[model samples]
Target: MILYPAIDLKDGKAVRLLRGDMDKATVFNDDPAAQALEFVAAGCEWLHLVDLNGAFAGEPVNAAAVEAILSQSKTPAQLGGGIRDMATIERWLDKGLARVILGTVAVENPALVREAAAAFPGKIAVGIDARDGRVATKGWAEVTDVDAVELAKSYEDAGVAAIIYTDINRDGAMQGPNIEATAALARAVTIPVIASGGVSSLKDLKDLRDCGAALNGAISGRALYDGALDLKEALKALAG
Candidate 1:
């Protein structure tokens, strides 16, 4: 299991939103590139980035910040939010993104997900963010009736790299991840499932690891930023 330190970009600054609410953002750092490097120095193998502005606009809005991070960090990073079309996907990949995560497209336009996944195997992933176990789209602003597991299963044959399961209610709240729900969804799908949301402690990571069936990795943000979890220790534990 890889511990991805999240550098969520909001207005070109690293900020974390409470419950996925854009208006409720807390700025953690102004220099995202430096932040990315810090995470890499801390021994994190991969970085997770989200474009908050892009997710709402349905287009790339924080390219400069993302580029800065890419240019400075040696570790691979995966990005999501506002990456809806092939051109955007191509552009990001051309700019050196290791993997592009499709959330809205996976729900609104699945064919595009298939096309991108087919075009770039192991370079595209689906971000299934759920509120109340039902998937949400457009950055969690809109909730759909689709079950999170069903949505993940729909993309199994699409050849996506991984299914990023985020429990929106747990996100940025330091409440701990939805391990039971995430484990259940992972078991229900063939694709690798990465857990997100509310990962506040090392104990939480151990719990996810102990799930033992389909758990792949977990994403953490606020806990890391606030010093509640140590990146180096977590990485060592995961690697061991």
Candidate 2:
């Protein structure tokens, strides 16, 4: 399983929230590019970035911060949040993002997901943020009755590179990822699935890896920032 170090951008700063709560954000660093460099230095293969402000606004709000990280890092970064249109998707990909993750669009306009995947191939991915097995849109502020597994199955033929599954309840809580649910989603879809949310420790990564072995990668945020999971050790564990 691939270990993706998460850099969540809130007001142009790297911050982590408690269970996806915006008011509970804890600023980790002011320089997101520097933080990305640190993760690269520690041996991260890919970087995961989210625009917290953009998610709520339904548009790109942290372009400058994301550009800075892209400018400085040699590592490939996949980004999500407020990337709802094809123009924005093309813009980010043109700006040199390794991949663009479409979350809200996946639930809202799935045809665009298929179109982008066909046009860009591996450059497109689907981000599914769920609260209690129901997919959430607009940055987890809105929950739908859509079953997570059903959503994953809907895009099976879309040719997306991967499905990033995030459990909002476990996110930033350091309680560990929803391995059972994530693994179940992975099994339900032919496309690759990357587990996210509440990845708090080395054990959590291991558990996620075991669960998502048939999947692609795992995303970690507060765990790495809070010293609960050492990036180097997690990398080694995932490699092993």
Candidate 3:
């Protein structure tokens, strides 16, 4: 399992939101590029970035911050938020994003996902953020009745690279990830599912590693920033 350190960009600063609430964010670093480099420095294999402003805007608003991270780090990165159309996908890929995650659009227009997957091959991933098993869209601002497992199943044959599954209620709360729910979703589909939301300690990471489902990896934010989870130690545990 690969360990992905998260850098959530809000207004050009790296911050972690409490349960997807923009108003409840805690800024971790003013220079996101330096923060990304720190992760790379810590031996992290991959970086997970989300454009918070972009997610709500329906377009990329943290372009400069993202560009800064890309310019500094050679480590492969996956980004989600505000990537809505073919043009945006093309642009991000051109900007050197290793993988572009299609979240909101995956729910609004699945055909675009198929088309983009066909075009990008392994460079495209689907982000399914759910609350109580229902998918949320528009930056987790709206909850839909669509079952998360069903949505993931629909993309199984679309040639998408992977699925990033975040349990909304657990995100940023540091309550630990919903392993049962996330693993159930993983078993329901063949796509590689990366667990997100609350990844708090070495135990949490190890639990996910031993969870039996074939998950891609896990994304940790607050725990890492709050010093609750040591990056180097967590990486070592996941690698084990």
Candidate 4:
């Protein structure tokens, strides 16, 4: 499993939001590109980035920051937030984003997901952020009754690269990931599932690795920033 270091952008700075709350953000780095290079130097295989401002505004709010990271690092990065259209999707992919994650659009306009997945082929991923097992969208500001598993299964043949499953309640809480829920979702579909949110320690990474489900990998944020989890140690642990 790949340990994807997360770089969440808020107001052009790298920050982490507790439980997806905008008001509860903690800025970690001012230069996101330098941060990406640091993670790359630390041996992270992939980088997971989110545009907090873009997710709320429905457009690329942190494009400059994202572009900077892309230019600085050769490591493949996947990004989510404020990408709800074909043009934006194409723009990001054209500018070197290895993959583009569709969240709100996956819930609001699933056809776009299908179209993008088919058009890009192994470059489109669906980010299913859920609370209490129901999918949340628009940066987790709105909750829906849509069942997470069913939605994932619906896209079973959509040719999506992966499903990034995040549990909102645990995000940035340092409580650990929802292993059972994430494993179940992975087992329910053929497309790869990447667990996100929480992911507090090396044990959590080990737990996810040994969860017995065919998960693609996992994404983590605050813990790495706060030193609760050492990047080199966690990477080595997962390497086993």
> What TM-score do all the candidates reach, one by one?
0.99, 0.98, 0.99, 0.99
Alpha carbon lDDT of each predicted model:
0.93, 0.93, 0.94, 0.96
Residues 1-240, model 4: lDDT tens digits: 999999999999999999999999999999999999989999999999999999999999999999999999999999999999999999999999999999999999999999999999999999999999999999999999999999999999899999999999999999999999999999999999999999999989989999999788999899989999999999888887
Instruction: Name the weakest run of 10 consecutive residues (lDDT summed) in model 3.
Output: 231-240
Q: Pick the candidate with the highest lDDT.
A: 4
List the candidate 2 regions with Cα displacement exceeding 4 Å: none
lDDT of 3 by residue, 1-240 (tens): 877899999999999999999999999999999999989999999899999999999999999999999999999999999999999999999999999999999999999999999999999999999999999999999999999999999998999999999999999999999999999999999999999999998889888888999888999988989999999888876776
Residue 212 of model 2 has an lDDT of: 38
lDDT for position 48 in model 1: 98
Global Cα RMSD, each model: 0.7, 0.9, 0.6, 0.6
The collision pairs in model 1 are none
Once model 1 is optimally superposed onto the true structure by TM-score, how far is the C-alpha of residue 198 displaced, in angstroms?
A: 0.4
lDDT minimum window of 10 residues, candidate 2: 206-215
Which of the predicted structures, 2 or 4, would earn the higher lDDT when compared with the native? 4
lDDT of 3 at 109: 98
Clashes of each: 0, 0, 0, 0
Q: Which window of ten consecutive residues has the lowest lDDT sum in model 1?
A: 209-218
